[model samples]
Target: MTPRLSNQMEKFYKFPDPPELAVQLRTYSVQRWPTMNHEWRKNKLASILRMKARRLASYWYAEESLSPRVDELEAILALLKLPEEVIERENLNELQALKERVARLEALLAQAGALDLGEQVDGGS
Candidate 1:
């Protein structure tokens, strides 16, 4: 399989399987399944799953639409995964060094009378 597909499979495996998820959902719901009719139970389950999918889609995609098809929801969740890449660690040391260098250069320019202190330095010392 392609690397991207492999990575997606790896991510998908990290989450619980559909059956386990369904069981968990069942436990989470307050519905009394034994008293409810079969057809109504099935509809309720489908409704719960779709509601969950819409919530997840809103969180992950930042946009919500009318209900997506089951296959579309599954594809979106299984393939796309969470946005773990949104945040990246910046090189703080490098940034600090650059800031210090700029400060020093600014100081030198001020000393040489090349830089005016008349509201030009907005970042007041």
Candidate 2:
């Protein structure tokens, strides 16, 4: 073997497989259950899983899309309630933070069927 070729060969060494590894590989290949049923059950299961994933994703997105103004009422809560990534990305200022807090409160109020903002009150004097 030439010195240059021997020096290059040193970088890549072919690993010798153990006897047990070879036996395991052979058995695994033969026992592998790769065949799957191409029927409606699998299709239904896949569709259900897909819908579940979409629902979960929508929930996450809903939680994330908040008004920054309502977020800063309680100094501690605003920080605690913020998602990890958002907190890491940037610090919320006073105005935006306040918006977030207000938004959250509004959401709760709306859920409780109170704090009617859309109604115009009139004094019939």
Candidate 3:
């Protein structure tokens, strides 16, 4: 008897490397600033997070004390009561920006007949 492959097994999964993941998290946090509830809290946390991101990025690149930075990040996440995974998900504003960019790129590529309609329709199956 042949075993059936799960949907997860059928697709390629590529996670971002540590530095890239840090950048993504930082970008997500900064993008979240405008929609944050309280004005002062929003400004304060955002600034602190950016600073932390800079420090963390430097330490990450230098291979220095990483645990402290990670602990700081966790504390920030806990104070915010936000899960890291939720923060990693694309927000609405970012989604709209990405959609616009994709549309523009698609238009340009379509002109050059570089868009693959078949693969898109088939969902790469």
Q: Which candidate achieves the best lDDT against the true structure? A: 3
The lDDT-based order of candidates, best leading, equals 3, 1, 2
lDDT of 2 by residue, 1-125 (tens): 99999976653333212333224323322332124332332343225334343332332233344222211213223323456556444434534787999999888757655645334322322
Q: Which digits, one per residue and each the tens of the lDDT, describe model 3 over residues 1-125?
A: 23455544333123334455445544545556545544443345546566544454543344335533444555454534566556556355667898999999888768545655655745756
State the number of backbone clashes in model 2: 15
Worst 10 residues of 1 by lDDT: 82-91
**Superposition TM-score, candidate 3 onto the true structure:** 0.29
CA displacement after TM-score superposition, residue 117 of candidate 1 (Å): 94
| lDDT, model 3 | 0.52
Candidate structures ordered by TM-score, highest first: 1, 3, 2
The 10 consecutive residues of candidate 3 with the worst lDDT sum are: 8-17
lDDT of 1 at 51: 49
